[model samples]
Target chain A: MKLLSGEIISNEKCGKGLYKIEVFSPYICRNANAGQFVNVKCSPDGILDPLLRRPFSIYNVEKEYNVFSILYLEKGKGTKFLSDLKKGSNLNFAGPLGSSISIGDRSKNFLLVGGGIGIAPLYFLARTLIQKGKNIFFAAGFKDNNFIEWSGELTRLGINYRIFTEDGSWGDEGLATDFVKENIKKYKNYKIYCCGPRDMLISMQDILAGKKISVTALLEERMACGVGVCRGCAVKIKDGNGSFVYKTVCKDGPAFDLMEVIFD
Target chain B: MIEGSGINLSVNLGRIKLKNPVVTCSGTFSSGLEYSEFYDVSILGAVTTKSFSFVSRAGNPPPRIWETTCGMLNSIGLQNEGIDFFIKNHLPKIKSLGAKIILSIFGDDPGEFKKIAREVKKVESSLLAVELNLSCPNVKEGGIAFSSMPAEVEKITEAVCKILEIPLIVKLSPNSDSIIESAIRAKCGGAEAVSIINSIVGTAIDIDTFKPRLGNVTGGMSGPAIKPIALAKVYFLAKADILPIIGMGGIYDWRDAVEFLVAGASAVGVGTANFVDYEAGKKIIEGIRNYLSKKGINDINKIIGKAIC
Candidate 1:
């Protein structure tokens, strides 16, 4: 991975408390994949406030223009500083980090599940899968109607998708877990790829347990060095012998088999 | 005119000699597992592994780290697969890289420290030195308490030093009552060198949640914010002439490393800076060589205490 300076091409408010920032970095955009992320240095030089770089999933990549975008919410100090960045400012970023989601056997049906902002990476994955001429089923859940901004893009891509909202003011009412529990058995041979809050992932895992389906989750944790040197962002994984070993989310995965995760 | 190629960056820490003075701090470099993928691990002075105990530690839960202004607070609780795993799985790989290895050992008491040190000595070969980490502020039992007391520091250092054939480097804590006194005690206990200023104890709170930001409630703070405090400590230790100080705190680049060397450090450790820039060690090495050549200083040893009057 290379540490390159990215100039902001545009930063726009895409949804409620969500932003889509596109940056110009040929080095990162050329090598970036679907599930990989970028560690963005939000603060300016000589400013130590908000000292760590925030890791964001690669939302989209336009290799022709050498531009990549990241979808983020105003969660804390780092993103709050990032939200204030303008069109012409320079941002130092290190990336194409973390392991990418493995697409095994393109002939099988690909079922993608995402919750809230976790859909950022899944959008990239769906685009790649569609281009590969694979059968894709996408389902996303948001808190309310204000978060359904990506539906338009999904439609333009001619992707068959379902949207759910907790407030019942949007599409289907209830969690994404409810959607999976209702229609998961319809596909014969499939692999489930999911990303979202831990609660949502766990709920879906509970419904899929003891089944023949294979599920890979794009996990999330508070990370410092996205390069795996700092030993931050560790997640416990159960080995084959029913014991748990600590694997870092930055290196060993931002993706892991759902069966291996020992979510405490 | 021997301007670029004649610059020598080698350094001597007690009986141990290093190719350069840039070392990765303990608990940051991950025993050369992750960093070797980015750059050659042997380019630095030495690679200090993360602190390991006798038994495996699960460490703290999620939210173990929090970002502050110019620094970070972490209570990782010394997570490791224990000394046994390091010897079996990690040592051969680290040894193969041909980098000087300084094994950092931590424990809950003097006896535990001696036990782990003895075990490490028996299995590992080509070890440059053993760093006894007496100043980890995250754990409650054997960390800050031992380093805070001069008598306990002397006891632990002497206990660990008696068992090993290699030189012992005692890592000091900044939160102690008197850092210089602690260093002097380590020297009396036969420590070859001292690594100053392990992360200082600090805390942060979430304004909206009205609760602690870190899962451990408190953690040791490191980065640029702590550089000034670390520099002063290294200066005082060097002024006292207690022992050769391996100074570190908020070292980001070559200028920061040079500041530590001039403040009386025989070597410098790069910790939190690795999180910011993964290739910081390589960049700093080049920066130091360029600075030395430009200043017409042939040997790095001449600049060890150049700033001290």
Candidate 2:
């Protein structure tokens, strides 16, 4: 992966404690994929306030304009600094990390399950899969109307989607996992991809436990080196040897089979 | 003459000499493979492999690392694939990268350190030196860090130094009041040089979870936050006129590296910067070269101990 700097096109506050930072980088626009991520230097050049780079999933890519964007929640010092970035300021980051996911030519039906800000990568995945003439259905759960603008963006792309919120202020008054549980039989032949909070992903894993459907999870963890070096961001995975081995989310996967992943 | 041009950046650390005074800290760079993807590993003086043991270890549980204000804490517990796997598989690959490798070894006891040292002696031709890691604060195998006890430090050093032909550098910690004493003991035990400051023992608590942030409860703290403390220890050893020192802690840029050199460090180790920028060593090397040349200095050795000398 290349460490390059791009001019910040925009850093907009999309919702409560949420930001969408778009940057102009042809390298990322050309090299990055749907399921990959970029580790951003949250602080200014030479400033190490937040020592490690923050990992953000690729929310969108506009190859035509040589730009890419990441959806972030301003939970810490890093994203707060990112949210304050002015237009034309240089943003440094290491890119196209982890294994990139793509769609199978024969697989026509695809379902995306996302929870809260976890919808970032799935949006990029859905946008790419739709271009391949695949039938896509998105079911996402949120805490509030934080994703109302995101739903508009999805509709603009003509993607079929369903939304769930705990407050019933959006689409349905329930959790996304509940929706998937009731409709699991209908999505029997559809390939499933999910990204969300740990409990939500775990709930989905339990819902599809005995089912034959293929499911891949997009995982996020606090990381130092976004490459394979540090051995810091580890997740338990079935190693085919009965027990499990700690696989780094930065390298081995930000994406893995829901069945192979063992959640504590 | 143009400033920063044609200046020598090399230094001799006791019995061994480095083309430059920059080395990656043990447990930070991990055999220099992942970082090699970003920049040439050979650019730095040497790449210190993550500490290895006689047997492979999976290490402590997650979350193994947590970022603080200007530093981070890690309890990796020296998770490595054993010395044999490194020598047979990793050494040749890193050697091919043209980077000088310093094998870092740690053990639960003196015997374990000697076993790893014996293995290093077998592959001495491939390594520049052997660094005995006596400062790891994560594991509790010995009920305490070897660095905290000067006697155990000497005992371990004496046993491992007996089996090694290459220069030995003991990596000491600043966890106790007897760090200089431990360094003296290391020097007495046959070590040619000392790597000042392994990470300090520190812990962080999550306010939300109301528990310790690290799964290991406490981990070794490293990065820019620890530089001042590291510089003092380096100066302490340098002032004591013991073994040559490889000073490291919180060194992020060339200015910090220069500070360590001025404080009497024969060499500087870049630890946490490699996490923020994979090519931090390469940039620091270039920066040092520029600093030396711009200041009208012709050799890096001329600046060693410049402040206190």
Candidate 3:
């Protein structure tokens, strides 16, 4: 079903240069999955730069009143325009699209690694797994401690959470991949999930190359159509012919098994 | 006060009623259908499907798009699931949308359009219209972009019009020197409507990298920059008899829609604007409504071709 256009019920600056815009999209809030996303059209009048829709991972969805939230860093014109939206402003978007994470196949003991805004989907994944009695360990990487937004929930749920900042002002100094590599031995039988920059995922893949750890990595790439028709978001995959064929990131997955995809 | 603010604007495309005109350009929002759940689909005037072909196309490799100052360049290579798969999986779902569905169909030759259109006509209840993407640059045929010549455009338009009983919208290419001639041929071939212009042929160079921005080396450009050219082509096409005009090119708001209407379009297709604002269509509707009210006009049709006069 098509999601209804949302009104910006509120906008507030949560941290330095980062803002949270709450939209009342009942349809989306109710149907959006943890790993899904929404394509937001930033300029209502079309005078802005980058005249194309921007896709963001579902940060959170409140099904009760049908409210959805996106936490973003005001990086480009699109984000800047979104940040400027006031209460009662209307924003058009479409979503809860893309391949969702199937929690049914995951192990009871789970480890989630996120970097920057990649933490968006991790929050929802951790919450769902925790509800099912999955032992959750979430480690995040950011430029600074100000980027951490899940402290209270992590504490309340009794989920073991760690933070790594690039400047070493947070829990650790290096990338989140190192922590996964160093700690993989301790959680040998656990399922590993990660979302972050390409380098981080690639580095993690190298560390677990010979290990017995199962990994599901979320990738970010350029996509033209959210559906498989565009072929703009094709990622290399094993075809029936035993050769690597192109499958859509939006359809085949934003999340794929480590063995199924080939990284640059 | 801005025009779109405080306006309850929405529209219906086929069966789906969008909250507005602002929508992601086809091939720009590749999160898949799932993303529609988190965002507002009702805010768009319509959701145009990505260009599809007779068979599944792998499209071009990575670096398919590059962001320019006011627009984006893309050479997606017209990747698709083929018409058969689209009907099997996508058709059933599109029928359920609250907004209108515009199918963008691309083919290598005239026969492909007719074949796809025939199949699509079977599920016409799910769609508002079929957009002929005969204009996309040919990936396999040394980039001999279709819709550039009048003969090819006429051939495809006539072929699809023969098979499909529903509205046939031919999307025209801006790369051609004589856009009106192509429009005339399409109209003569029985196009129910004509949409122009589909991205200008362009290329972007990376200064430091010393290479073209797109993987295909060349791409079609869309955004505000192309608005003038699109408007001119649309105006020329509107001069012809029969069928309606769906004008598009960097349309961001109500004023843009008005321009298209004056230039001889019945309805406007908003593409590039979706990237800037998802609610652009809604806002544009509101803006147009207010403009109409202020001008003491009850029906929008009165303004059609007014600019040409």
Candidate 4:
């Protein structure tokens, strides 16, 4: 991975508490892959207030223009500071960090599941699989219709997708995991890839396990160095010897087999 | 005028000689594998591996770290894969890097410390020294307990010193009532050097949630915020003339490293700075060379304790 300065091409509020920031950084975009993330230095140079860089998944990449976008929620001080930046502001970021999802066997059908902001990386994966002429299905959940983002892009790509919202204001009045359970038998032959809140992922894992369907889930944790060095962002995974070992989320995976993970 | 390449950055920490005075502090650098992507690990004086014990540790749970004013607090609980894993998986790669290796060992008591040290001696040959991590304030046992008391510090040092062939450097905690006394006791116990000022015990509370920010409730604080306190400790240790000091705490740049040197550190370690910049150790090495060349001081040893005498 390389540390490069990315100039903001545009920053817009895409939905409630959501932002889509597009940056022009050839160094990162050229090498970035699906499921990888960038560690952004949110605070300005010489200011160490929010000392650590925040990690955001690569939402999309436009290689022709050497541009990439990150989808994030204005959750804390670091992200709030990020939202205030105008067009053409240069931000320092390190990427394309963490292990990418295994595309594996393009001939196999793919089913993608995303929840809230977790949809960020899944969008990139969907785009990639669609371009390869692979049959893809997307199932996403937001708090409500007001929080939904990226459905239009999915339509433009001509990819089949389903949306769910908790308050019945959007398609399907239920949680994402409920939707996945209802549709599991229909997509029995497809390989499943999921990204969402920890509870959603875990519950979905239980549903998939009972059906004997394998899945890959993208995990998230508070991290210091988005590299393996600090041993921050560790998640327990079953070793080959049947014992659990702490694998760093930033390195060993941001994407791991749903079966191997031991969530606390 | 001294040539740029001719500046002597090598340092002698009693029995061990380092190519330079810039060592990656334990727990931050991670055995040189992670930072190797940025720069060669051998360029640093030595790479101190994360401290380990006889048994593998799972470490603390989530929210292990939290950001503070100018630094960060971490209670990683000395998370490691134990000594056997180090010998089997990590040591070969670290040895291949060609940097002087200093194994940081942590144990609850004197016998455990000796056991770990004995195992380390049989497997590794290129070790510059074994730094006894007696001052980690985060762990529930065997960390600050040994360093806080003078007699325990002496006992552990002497116990490990007896079994090891290489030099023993006792790392002392700044949280103690008398750091000087601790250093003196380490010297009396046959430690060749002492690396002072491990992170101070600290805590942070989330104003919104009205709860502790870290899962461990408290952790050891490090980064630019602790540099001044580290310098003062180094200055005090220098005044006592106990042993060669390997000083560190919140070192961010070359100027910070120099401050420790002038305060009387035979060598300086870069810790939290590694997180801010992966190549911080290399940059600090260059910065020290430039500072020495500009001042027309050809030898780095000449600058040690210059602030006092």
Candidate 5:
């Protein structure tokens, strides 16, 4: 479906410049999977000033309540408009888009890593794995205490998570990268998923090189026509033939192997 | 034939005909594959494909899109899987959908355009017309857009017309030095119609990092912001009374479409609106019908050049 409307259940500030909006959309709850996204129209009804729809990863989907949540930072005009939307107002979007995650080797435990707003999609992944009777450990890192309240989301969801912030204001004082490095031996065999800042993803790519662990990174880019047509969110992938071809992050993946992605 | 409205919405581009006057811009609607998931694309007058080529193409790198106040800047460097891929994959699907198609093709030069037009000639029976894409701003082919030069426009149009049995429509640019000359030249080259205007050349800068937002540093701007400029261009060519004009640029709804028609456009192209609402085309089609019914105008052709008169 191209345009789906959802009513805002709650839109609240979670931390410094961070927001978590829950929307009531039975269609999305039934259709969307972890790692997919919804492209939202940020402006008010009949307003095309903010002309493009913003793509946000499906942060969490609560099937029981027929609701999905999005965690975003007040980054730009679009996010600002989204943040200002009042509760019970209708939001229009086109979604359940992008590639769904292919959770491989269920027998292996799950290791989820997130940085900043990248934690949004990981929450849904953790929730899905937990429901599937999998053992998952979520390791998240933030710049400061920016995502302080977001940590509460994991706690409320009963996810086993370790928090790391640079300022030590929120959790353990260190980088999530360092934590992953410190705990690599213990979780090397675990199925891993990471989403975060590009710098962090680059670092994760470097750290996980030749570790023989399955890792998927959710990528975000400035995109138009959240479907494959526009070729806006194209990323180079190392095809099996050792050469690279341009693959759209929207269609081929917002989820791809950390090793296969050539992030320039 | 238009349901109960008693309005004759059917229109003629040239030797060919369309059930309605609304079409999708090349590169924006993706030959109607994705949009077909939302509505029956047969409702459209025609579907113009993204720029066709003799060989497949890979578009620009990431950060190809940047949003502005009332529009967007995109540098999607015409990525497509060539004509062979389109014929084997998209053409059959479009045929199945039972919608008229216009093949919009681009080339590095007139010779290359002639080559693609020859291939198009093989499938001309399936297409309503051929659209020559002479003014895409993103690619660095020959260092600038071909439509910028009037002589090149006439030369390319004439070359393609020789091979194509179907009517030819020349797609022009707002960034051209003088689109009037280009349109006149296209008419001289035996083109049956012209689609104006392609995205205007523009740029957006990231304030945080103080760097260019698009990976290509510049892109073509489209949306409601360019509507007035498009209206002026369409009005000009229609007054020139050369060939039929297909006007487009930020047409969002039926009102925008009607504005283009009143300004002397025989048809309108829906571009950026497809990205905003999947049902934009459907709504515009319905809206045009309702508008015609309400105004007591029995024929859509009656509205063309009304503003110019």
Candidate 6:
């Protein structure tokens, strides 16, 4: 991946607390895939407190305009700087850097599960799957109604959607796991795709075990080189000899068979 | 006479031929993959990859790194995809970047080192050299710091040398009390080159919370603060003339790169500075060129060992 000087084409609040930043980086946009991320060099000289680059998944690619949009939560310094960016600010970024989810046989029904910010990537995947004429089933978990901004996007795409919250303020009062267990037969013919906190993915893997479901999960790990050069993103897998083996998330995957990963 | 033209900035480390004396230290900036989209990887003398191990590691939990003045401390936990996966997947990608790939290997035991080295050597076409990480104390066994014990260092390096035909750079740990002895042991163990002063063992505590700043509790300190110590080691080790020294510590600019050269190093490695700016290597290269032009140096070879009295 190459680092490009991206001008902020647009920064708008898409829904709720999330902001959509459309950065115009011709170099990155040309090579950027759906699930990969860019390490944004936030400030010009560098940022204070949080000095390292922030990682963001590529939200969407506007090829004709040579721009790629990143959706992020403005919680820390890196995102804070990113949010306050003027219209023409330039960001030093590297990208098309991680593994994307595998989209196979569009004719089969697909079940997607995403938790909190994890929904960012599933949105991209959802768009891709819909383009291929797949019947999509979605289960999204958020804290409350304030985080349900993505509902409109799903409705627009004509996707079958369900929302779960820890509190009963919106959707169901239980977790996504509850919703899946309650509605397993509905997704029996579909492949399951998941992205979220580690526990959520692990839970999904457990509930779907021994079923006809094929599960692929997107994992998040702290990374140094979005490329495979740094092993910082390695995840443990079960070895053939009933031992443990390691795989890199950046190259080998951000996507892997749910059964292959040995989650802690 | 041109101001900097007379200086020779070229040095040979084992089989790898570098255009200049500056190199990037491992675990910093990483290879072309990090900024491959924005920066030119070929402009640097060479790229040292982050340390890798035999197993895939998630590394230490978040809050893995902290930035200090002019440098940083990281407890990356020796995270890496196992050697098998690296050779199968990453080698071709790294080779495509055109920079000399210095494979950094770390493990818990000498046998693991041999395994990684053997597999890496099997794909010698993609790698220029193998750098054994012996300094990290985070792992339960086989840290690069194994060289702290002269005999063990010799034994480990020897074992690695036996399996690989490519040049071997024994990355020395600064945690040792006597770095010279470690260097000597590495050479005796069949190492063709040595990289001095992997981050010194250091710690950072938050004032408000009064606790360790990194998730790993302690970390290897890198950047300008460790340069003097690194320079001293390079200076003394280069005296042996048995192996080339890849000197690095706190090297943020070309002038700093030149210091390692003047201190008797054939090449230098850039760390910490790589994170501060994406074009750090190119800027340093330009600065070195300007220094050479000012000194009236045409061939970089003359600069090696120029500091000798």
lDDT of each: 0.86, 0.89, 0.71, 0.87, 0.88, 0.74
Among all candidates shown, the one with the greatest lDDT: 2
Please give the distance, in angstroms, between residue B265's alpha carbon in candidate 4 and its true position after superposition.
2.0
**What TM-score, over all chains together, does every model reach?**
0.90, 0.96, 0.75, 0.93, 0.97, 0.79
Worst 10 residues of 5 chain A by lDDT: A99-108
lDDT of 4 by residue, B1-309 (tens): 124578888898888888899998999988888888889988889998889888788888767778888899888888898888988898888888787789888997888887898788797576888989999998878788877688999999888888887998888999878788888899888999999889999999989999898888998999889999999999988988889999999888899999999999999999988887778899999999999989998899999999975
* Per-residue lDDT of candidate 3, residues B216-281 (tens digit): 898888878788988988787777644566688878678888898889876777665544553455
* Alpha-carbon DockQ of candidate 5: 0.77
lDDT of 1 by residue, B1-309 (tens): 123578778888788778889898999898987778778988889999999899888887667788888888888889888998998888889888877899999999888988898798796466888898999999988899977788888998898877888888999999977788888889889899999889999999999999898878999999999999999999988988888889999998899999999988999999988888778889888898889889998988999987887
Docking class for candidate 5: medium
Provide the lDDT at B53 for model 5: 83
Model 4 chain A lDDT-worst window of ten: A146-155
What value does the lDDT take at residue A232 in candidate 2?
Answer: 88
lDDT of 5 at B240: 85
lDDT of 6 by residue, A1-264 (tens): 665677788887755657888888777767766567777776555323344566787877767888888877877666778888877877677677787666767547888898878887787788778778888888989877766664776678788888888877888887887788778887788888888888898888788888857888888775544566545456777776887656767777787888878876
Q: What is the lDDT of residue B116 in candidate 2?
A: 84
**For residues A164-199, could you state the per-residue lDDT of candidate 2 as single tens digits?**
999999999999999999999999999999999999
- Give the residue spans of candidate 2 off by over 4 A: B1-4, B142-144
- Which residue pairs collide, candidate 5? none
Clashing pairs in 4: B223-B250
Off by over 4 Å in 6: A13-17, A26-30, A46-49, A148-154, A239-241, B1-8, B12-17, B26-132, B154-168, B184-193, B202-244, B250-256, B262-264, B271-283, B294-309
Task: Output the TM-score of candidate 5.
Answer: 0.97
Point out the higher-scoring one by lDDT: 3 or 6: 6
lDDT of 5 at B95: 85
List, residue by residue over B109-134, the lDDT tens digit for candidate 2.
99888888878888898889999888
Question: Model 3, A66-122: lDDT tens per residue?
Answer: 888887778888888888889998987777778778887447788898988788777
Best by TM-score: 5
Tens digit per residue, CA lDDT, model 6, B1-309: 224455444567877777666667777755456555556676667878777777766566445556565456767777665777777776677678777778888877788887777677778767778888887755546664485677778888999888888888888877777578878788888898888878877778989999897767887777666788888777877776657888887786788888888888888888776665567788887787787778877766667768855
